[model samples]
Target: MTTESGAGARVNCVVDAEGRVALELPAPVAATRPHLLLRLRPKKGEPVTVSRTVPLEAVADGPARAVLEPLPALEEGRWDAFLLNGPDDTAPERLRPGLRDLRALVDGHLRDRPSPVAVRIPYVTKEGYLAVRAWLRTAHAEAGRIDVGDRSTTVTARLHGATFEDGAVVRLRMRGSDAPERDVRPVTDGDHLGFRFTVDHEDLAAGTAAEGGIWDVFVHPAAGAPPIRVARLLDDVADRKASFVHPAARAAGAVLRPYYTLDNDLSIRVATG
Candidate 1:
């Protein structure tokens, strides 16, 4: 919440391939029995917080190092980082981002891993404070490369904590409507799937009555399993709506655009003339 980093407590975080966070802190703060506290950013649901104490050790002349175990993963949300100076410290100070090393999360390192996929990425907030982005899903379809063609759009995604079945398909459901869902069978390769579906501009325009509306995307991995929302949340980028822009395809007096929602989920929008 506070814009300025408090108490000059800067932290450099290194996230390993297994989601372990190693923190390098200044010697003065480390000597105070420092504890790391992560408070989830307020949203529509109940608030959550995770706190862990740092084990102090003599570092000779180097900065104090502590590791935050990855067990008991955090919930899916943005968490603000705070540094509690000691056990008696009631008011924890917000930490500033020093250096973030998150290369282990690139290129779907955790793909094909066990069930209940867990991903945590450390990032600097817009307010100049250190925070973390966490995602926990029983089954997830991570949206990858997207190609917007004149007649259709192709979407490639990697599946985690789940596998594709015989009847796997991608579904595009119009928001707030009783319109029938549009389903497209995808090409599956190992743990990856590619969806090439026609973007029926005319039907979209008619569905929304010439007014633009959103179409949420989902992937049904198996017949019995529930459909998983298509999203992109593997790397260090906390937000992708502004950075990942797609070209609009215009046809039949309608304009179709694919975009990522505020929560990084993939969706389509249709506008009519």
Candidate 2:
């Protein structure tokens, strides 16, 4: 909660592709016993907790490193992160243990403290859990940028560290409760991929909107390639306030817009006139 980088202990953390949490510590802690504590509390389900003794691997007595294997993928919801000095009578500080629910977080939110030097962010997983992911100082896919309008919708994205095979195809797949999956291939452009899909006015009517007009976006590569979710990475969601989201409502005409959720996934809002 403190904005100070090393207010208590200066540490750096990251989440790897395999879903493990890795921690790096400064010089002083190499001699003292170190412990890693992780707590996951979902919005609607039981909480999860994991603890491990961090083997102090010395690097010139300066920076130390440790890795904690991944916990089971959580049920969909929001989760908070804490890198506490686990229970040790010999250590200087012992952070309180146990996970906290959303109400606990809201009622007892960290306040009046220096802005937290946010080492981790609360994220939402594909399955719908609000969660936290390990930080990686590497380039990855950024799918937060999207364009939605009454006539059509467009998406432009690039996959970092990913290469496309020749003759591979990219597509935008959308579905609603009332409509079947609409798979449209996006036009490939210079370096990034671009997709433009038309929306019929009739599909925007208020009656049709109520049946589930909101749409989620996903990247569909070639037939054999695993579909990549077009999601916002880190802190790159620029259109949080303006994007249209939520199911469509009855109105005079159809209004289409895009929106980003707290978990950083993109959804479309359809309002029919």
Scanning candidate 2 in windows of ten residues, the lowest lDDT window is 108-117
Supply the global lDDT for candidate 1. 0.75
- lDDT of each structure? 0.75, 0.43
Q: Distance (Å) between predicted and true CA of 233, model 1?
A: 1.5
Candidate 1 positional error at 149, Å: 1.1
Q: What is the C-alpha RMSD of each candidate to the true structure, in Å?
A: 3.7, 11.0
Q: After TM-score superposition, what is the CA distance of residue 150 in candidate 1 from its true location, in Å?
A: 1.1
lDDT score at residue 13, model 2, on the 0-100 scale = 50
- Where does model 1 exceed 4 Å of error? 1-7, 44-62, 177-180, 190-198
Clashing pairs in 1: none
Alpha-carbon lDDT of model 2: 0.43
lDDT of 2 by residue, 69-101 (tens): 544333233344333433553333322211212
Candidate 1 positional error at 250, Å? 1.2
